[model samples]
Target: MPQVPIVAAHWVYLLGVALIVLTMIWRANVVVPSVLATFLVALAWTHSPIAALGSIFNASFTAAKELFNIFLVIALMTALLNALKVLRSDIRMVEPFRTVMKDGHTAYFVLAGITYVISLFFWPTPAVPLVSAVLLPAAIAAGLPPLGGALAIAIAGQGMALSSDYVIGVAPGISAKAAGVAVSAAAVADRALVLSLITGSVALLLGYFAIRKFITKPDDGLLERWQAKSSNGELARIAQEGTFDKVELARGTAGDQTPLANQGQIDKALAAIPDAREKWSKIFAVVTPLAFLGVIVVMVLSKLGIGHDLKGGDAAALVGGVAAVLMIWASFVTDPLREFLDTSADHVTEGFIFAFKAMGSVLPIAGFFFLGAEQGLSAPILGVPAAQAPNLLFELVQAAQHWIPGNQVFVAFGVLIAGMITGIDGSGFAGLPLTGSLSGALAPTVGLDPATLAAVGQMGAVWTGGGTLVAWSSLIAVAGFARVPVFQIVQTVMVPVLAGLVTSTICAVLIWH
Candidate 1:
């Protein structure tokens, strides 16, 4: 690739960063700025009005293509979660864990631990409801505040665990792509693991004490007090009422349909009916976990020189394939052959619906960032380069690297902080490639492992933007789901998040150095 002149495109890149920062400071969505910046940058670079128009479409579409895999994983996992809910296995899966949630402290750690593991495997969007639905009530019952439950999950799943992205590989894929490194490279994965653990551990400990101070003894009167103060009581009541209505309808239908049937026949059918859900659910719960575990085992074995070599998309394929098989098996066990087709279709449709609804806005937002990478978009920003394709952000980072010393600690912390600041835009992922590239460039100067610094940067960017500390980030979704104030979530998360970042940064300096 030929080097493109930085010139006007450099200023355009700075302007985009400014626009993003300004939007973030105002707690507004960065989507508009991203789109407008991509267009203007492309327009200025190409100087051809026609090309500018085309770049806008190209940037967004290219980004969508690049990120579609991530979108699919989220969708499939969500679909799987919803399916589990329908089978009621979602509830049963966590029932045993309730026994461990005997106190606020216990509940706090348990929720965090469970969320970290599950989200590590499936991603947070899908894992949220499962943790909330089953474990939340248990945590509340064990004297953990609803806010505490929320805090634990955000720290573990959204912040620490997701920052690394070991199993799903979404974060790594994006970071590596931006850094011009190979996916699954040792440097990126290893460093990401270390940094993520440091941050997550710190965040978890800080959150524990904050909750401890607020925990009330498990008194009967406390439930009433909490209900009185509960911002979400009405929502819960409405949901409960809706559930009751469904139960009532099922009972009425059973009564009406059973009339004139033999008592023995009716008894046998009713006995078998509950068994259908129970039997199939048991099979699915047992089979799904085992199947997923088997895939992981196979993947590990393959990495170690067994079976078949799996590369890009294979990891996702393994997960999706297993999920599909489980979906089919569950459908079959629940109904006869005739019903299986209908059930499968219904579930897949539901999965897609859930997937799109939750993530529709993200694609366009991602497209805007994706625009930064392409020459088609750059032509619109910086007049025609004879033969060079401009990388706006990467060029900016490289130009500025000389001003900053390659102090390993400083670079790691600086990148981490820059990532956290970018996350203020509430789109944690928008600037990863820039950070990742910068990390790689700076790493050689600092005598540091580029991957480790990149991973540290990844941690800061993701944890903040991914919803742990930022009120305006996806924390809104968590607040909405938990029926708590979004601002309160931010307040509760601040100490823990800061603690996590500091610990992770210190760990990087000490251990990696």
Candidate 2:
């Protein structure tokens, strides 16, 4: 086979990625560097300065269009959570779990279990609010440290559930597509599931032990201290400005004193709920979980080949649709008939604002990486035919392939590190195509299964960028909800997540090579 030429633009892309990774390690914002690098790479590849400027806009637009579903699901789920809050059904959802949580030791695992389950079905984007709003306070009240609560949610929801993405199938689907494999998404999903479990269990256990010394006896004082701490953080400013309400809900003091106008509105909203309708709060609480549970059961049955399988985006849509309907039902039950539509609209608007606040920064960063993936979004902007569009990252990796050692161990770790580097942008799934493409290319050279390599790469990308090791990722949501500093949570989970990644990679080589 003929060798592909290595161009100066390829080197520039590599340098750009290295700088982004270094910036992240230094605990600095990488968005500015990412945007600059995208412009430079586009300028070099297209040789047209004006076209390069256009590429920047096109890249971010493509990223937002591709990821808009994630934003929508987050908004729908958040809206559902807001409606639940009006009904106080959010608290009811976790009341039973609180009994089993009992103390710090049990609370840690309980939080992880519930978070993992819900995130697996609905994606962590949606599940985080529900878990944080309801179970987080319960876990805190049961003696889990605020940081501990954050770690459990990050490792379980973002790391474990998202890496497998078995129910929604998004992660594996992306990986399989990039690998150019004829295999089913389930082939990737199965391996990812086992690897994620190993990684998550190891990380969660190590995290628990690290924070064990900080655990205190069950006390209201712990919750109060956390609330105070949260009030001083970046998210607090949003809440103080009255733009965010979920923070107060997480602190379990939404009814606390506020501006009279705000208080009056809250009082009026509560008063509108007649005594008979109050029963619907508890009823919906029970029905909501059952509805979601049924969704999961049907998904599982489909996966087992007993029914039509809901794959990839279809599964996410199902969950989002269900949540939207539930939001409407809960809103109607909590307000007068004439006011329910307005109430629901307000909840949805708040949800969209929150979702954008949490994830808007990701768009530009994702755009830069998406360009490297030959996603076709930049072809028109660069004035190139789609077939001739450059895949900057893939070409660079292919050029360097001969220099990579033939050792399976070396290749596995190389892919793992590459995945981790790509993850520095802090959108875990955005880097999947790059890693998956590399995994497929390198696996044959190293005598390893492509699926196993893909799973190992997924582990690194999702675990690190997925929010456990990175402060600026979705981990911020975990930090915001748990009332802890984002970097502190990152510090607590770093060693454990690294250890888990190393161990799981080694296991993948042994089990599947």
TM-score of each: 0.81, 0.77
Clashing pairs in 2: none
Worst 10 residues of 2 by lDDT: 254-263
| lDDT over C-alpha atoms for residue 153 of model 1 | 83
Estimate every model's Cα lDDT from 0 to 1.
0.65, 0.73
> What is candidate 1's lDDT per residue for 436-461, written digit by digit as tens?
65665566667776667777778888
- How would you encode candidate 2's per-residue C-alpha lDDT over 364-469 as one tens digit per residue? 7667766776536556545678887876665676777789798898888988897887666566765666677667667767788877888888888888777777
Clash counts for the predictions, in order:
15, 0
Candidate 2 segments exceeding 4 Å error: 102-104, 118-154, 162-191, 207-276, 375-378, 421-455, 465-467, 470-494, 510-513
The whole-model C-alpha lDDT of candidate 1 against the native structure comes to 0.65
- How much is 382 displaced in model 1, in angstroms? 11
Superposed model 1: Cα runs more than 4 Å off:
1-4, 181-190, 213-217, 232-273, 299-308, 336-339, 357-387, 431-434, 440-450, 476-486, 509-513
